[model samples]
Target: MRKRKWSSALLAASAIIAAAGCGSDDPGTVSGSEVYDTCTTSIADNVPAFYKTYFRCVTITMSGDTVVIKTDGLPPHNTYYYGSGHDKYVAFDFSKGSDYHPNPNTLKQQNVTIQIPAAPKARGLTINAAAVDAKVNSSSNEYGLGPRGVALDGVSLFNPLAAPGDDIEDEKYTFDPYNAHPTNNGAYHYHTTSKGPLELLKKLGKTTNTTPGQAEIEVYGMMCDGTLLLGCKELDGSAPAAGLDSQNGHVHDIKDKAGTVHFTGRYHTHVCTSIGSHKYTPEIQYYDTCK
Candidate 1:
């Protein structure tokens, strides 16, 4: 698929339309380095079936041994961060109570391109010596406060780390119901469970359950280092059988909707907090190489 270029008139019109809380039923097709309005692009049919179902309004293609996914780094769902008058904007869920202070930052378009290993391998007992040891050198590969991974919904996933001189536990209070918030740079991201992605999967008939349960298997997303992120259950709606490593990771063949092996003997991590599991996306890098 060729990327379209945005003309000056389209940019100006999109800005006006967006501020007026309206967008085209058609994917806004204006082309540019950044996507400022609606996402009109489509994932290539040759892309993995898993991504095709989840990564809507984004572009996915293979580059050598990696799958390059390009997105605007914005949420397609409604949120207070979308700002008032924007079509995707909605009031904050005050059900979390009066303490839910919306962060100062708002959502914006970002030119983000995520490249993940096309075929990932399991780092058995002998890990990549050059890579930061997820078990021993935990501090070295800690996830920075940026795009650690891309969600199926095209938003970014941040590490669980708080800003300088702040506690992650304290930061939890600021997260919306989707367990996501924008950074100071206007980059919206999720550090934990995302109700939005789960709902998207359910809408696609990937799973039936919405709330946390043993019957709901959830594929959260993939990390930059080729680490697959899953929820409390496996693809078959079964709980994890083996103990996860320090990074909440383990290795096995994960299958797709048709029971075909999607990832053979690959490494992935679980970020299910619903079952009292404290795991989140690894702050530390474990793969030998990541782009």
Candidate 2:
């Protein structure tokens, strides 16, 4: 009888060990060179599954109600910003336009870690609330400049607003082929519609379109307050429903082209330049809690 009990206990221990090992071995797709390595698949089970499955070029972990994301903040694609010596570097295309000129800053790896609520709440009543903290202020839904969120390619997403006295419309011409540029400190980020996120979807076999506004389905990234950055169409490759706010945003379920539902009643904004007057990243934060 003692031998039988020992056998059962040993089996239980083995099962526990297997379960722990399974978390990191979750079919990760590690892509990229030494410049920017992307490890998207081998993530802990505690992290939200959507981020684990769809996102690339970052390492994700969860701590209680907060989701912690760590990335080098270097885009996994070719850019003139990567500098000439790097493998990912490309010569700037002078043919893009007469107004389009490369910014002086160069791209480099960044140690960026952002913490956000795993399950964010919408600010229905707090829409008009007073400000307290800039990171999670209620009154000020305005996104502060610099590193608002992470893009699909592990790049940073800045708000639509440019620096003080600098015109954002003018800055759009400074973006590279992927529609992104670096800050004065060398932090590369996306400010408007880009082929970066759409290209990732195509690489993952999720879609065939890679164009910015013309893609079949385009999704940029998640903001601190759980706002989804979408393109011309919804995730299912259909037209965005009517009644989008002035910011070209609305609350709805976020699903993929394959009919997999990722979030329910989520706030998402469209940044498609082809469809409407709004043609840049979202300015106002829709959800209540950011941290």
Taking all chains together, each candidate's TM-score versus the true structure is 0.77, 0.80
lDDT of predicted model 1: 0.66
lDDT of 2 by residue, 1-291 (tens): 011111335445535654566544333223221112333323355777678656777777788988777778888788999999988889987788898999999987888877767778876723221321222223366887788888877888888777876778788888998889999899999987788877777655556789887777888888777788888999888998776666677888888654768888888888875665667777777777654
Per-residue lDDT over 1-291 for candidate 1, one digit per residue giving the tens place of the 0 to 100 score: 344433556546645664575633222321223332355546554566556545555678777778888878878678888889998888887798787778888888888887888775433432232332323324545655678788877778777667776766667777777778888888888877687667656544456676544327787787787878788887766787666665566788887544657777777777776543455666655564566
Q: What is the C-alpha local distance difference test score of each model?
A: 0.66, 0.72
C-alpha-based local distance difference test score of model 2 = 0.72
lDDT of 1 at 110: 87
Please list all clashing residue pairs in model 1, or write none if there are none: 4-31, 5-31, 6-31, 141-284, 142-283, 143-283
* Model 2 root mean square deviation, Cα atoms: 10.1
